[model samples]
Target: MSDLPPENVQQYPRPPRIEPVPHLVVVRLGGETIAETTGAFRVLETHHAPSYYLPPEDVRARLDPVAGGSFCEWKGRARYFDVSAGGQRAPRAAWSYDAPSARFADLAGYLAFYAGLMEACFVGSERVIPQDGDFYGGWVTRNLTGRIKGARGTEHW
Candidate 1:
């Protein structure tokens, strides 16, 4: 037998969905060609709707500035960032956690963009339709009122 220790074994959890799903797209200000992510990354994927989490290092830091903050019971406290482009600024369009809880630490310092604010947002070129209430920002297909509750379509967000 090999001398490798059992502790070195690495097993990846079966994701709800696999690659080539065409689930995410990145658009920068001034119609810039940003990175396009097709695969569902671990820290940002969800069954109902997948997400694209960009590390702070991947974003154009020159256009980003700490703007606000929020909290999540599951993920922990979050800090927000504003993107400035062409003299116009989108405040709190991105969010991250510098020190997330153990289970969520992989998301630390990684940025999640709110598609509702960007100039162009898409899931493989499929534009995001905004839901009712300007307070929340995500891909909105239809008026999901009674269909969704507590932000996640009933008991889940």
Candidate 2:
């Protein structure tokens, strides 16, 4: 268990902040482990669960780049990736910011998986609950507290 205080999403920053995650992060799909890493970074934003980004080198499966991209005011351009393993494919299930803004430049090349699209995702031994909707890639764990964003009516939040 971590000695740090319990995290409440409500108290996270509006612009978001990145923190190093020492726990093991794992992504499972198509009945196999596609990615596993002890080194992960999480982006914390107000009203949202943490979005964990794994290093590119730690990912086992090949991520095929998708056509579209998006812009994050804080992070810069976001690129999509399709992940496949064991005959299952999740289109645009992952994303990365190649040219992030200076403040978030550390996120460059890190991949954040959509837990809902994968068979399972875990933080250490605890299975994570995916943040609602396909838009945000946050992962909700048992240790978190507060009303999270991403539900239908919370679009403006």
Candidate 3:
């Protein structure tokens, strides 16, 4: 019923894959008002690298505004935040890519943390930095064990 050539049809691109990067971030600050939590998040294994995403209502930790932010095509515009442990400030440790694309809007306002800057980071209680650099944020959870992976800029994964 068609007139086009068989090879003319192109397959649609695949969505970015988000594998779980198992890890835990423990917060121990001097302030009693702000609670300390361990292994309270999840990380994304993206094409560019890994990024940490924390459950909004699940995080017992308090966050303050940081100095910078940027835009993500798949996600959206983001805002950075600072974290405090024992009342000690860990600058720009949190970020939220608000107003993400329809497929990835779930990421909106969900905080992503950088393990390298936190007080302590553990991969299955092994004390490892999931990724090898400071540019990525490795997602984590309390009991989950695995690495997250996804392709950046691609809407479908």
Candidate 4:
């Protein structure tokens, strides 16, 4: 639906590629801008949507540690965060890999949000679509192509 050329997720690397994102990224919730950054990083993997991790300093929302955590083979363990802003709360809507593997060291302190839990998430001036499923925190943009993972049949991907 966008004029921009589409990129297939199948073309992305397997072990996952971490790259700095110079474009502005923003997250809005409850009529407030909870996070905004031009210094974010993106993790692109085969069959998955791109996950944007924003610097801690760029997020305006208060984050509280959640009770449970998850593990990622490539990033190590991930801790969840409850995002609170403008008197609204979204529990465990964000996550961070405090001590990521050496390959993903840049994401150690950055937080990746679940776009479905927020009022809106943006990449540059374009609003993003949250990758389907509650577990994966990928942000879908117009530039991405191919069938994304995270749907029911994609559980094994």
lDDT of 3 at 28: 34
Top candidate on lDDT is 4
Residues 59-91 of candidate 4: C-alpha lDDT, one tens digit per residue: 999899989899999999999999999889999
lDDT of 3 at 151: 27
- Residue 57 in candidate 3 has what lDDT? 65
Per-model TM against the reference: 0.60, 0.94, 0.58, 0.96
Question: Model 3 off-target regions past 4 Å?
Answer: 1-15, 19-49, 123-126, 139-157
Best by TM-score: 4
Better of 1 and 4 by TM-score: 4
Residue 100 accuracy (lDDT) in model 2: 91
Question: Which pairs of residues have clashing backbones in candidate 1?
Answer: 129-140, 149-154, 152-156
How do the residues 1-157 of candidate 1 rate in per-residue lDDT, one tens digit apiece?
2121121101212232222333455556546534455432423223123334665555653346575677866568887778765455777777777887776666777666666667765554456554334443434323112232124443444
**Model 4 misplaced stretches (Cα beyond 4 Å):** 1-5
| Cα distance off (Å), candidate 4, residue 151 | 0.7
- For model 2, what is the C-alpha lDDT against the true structure? 0.90
Name model 1 segments beyond 4 Å from true. 1-24, 38-51, 61-63, 141-146, 149-157
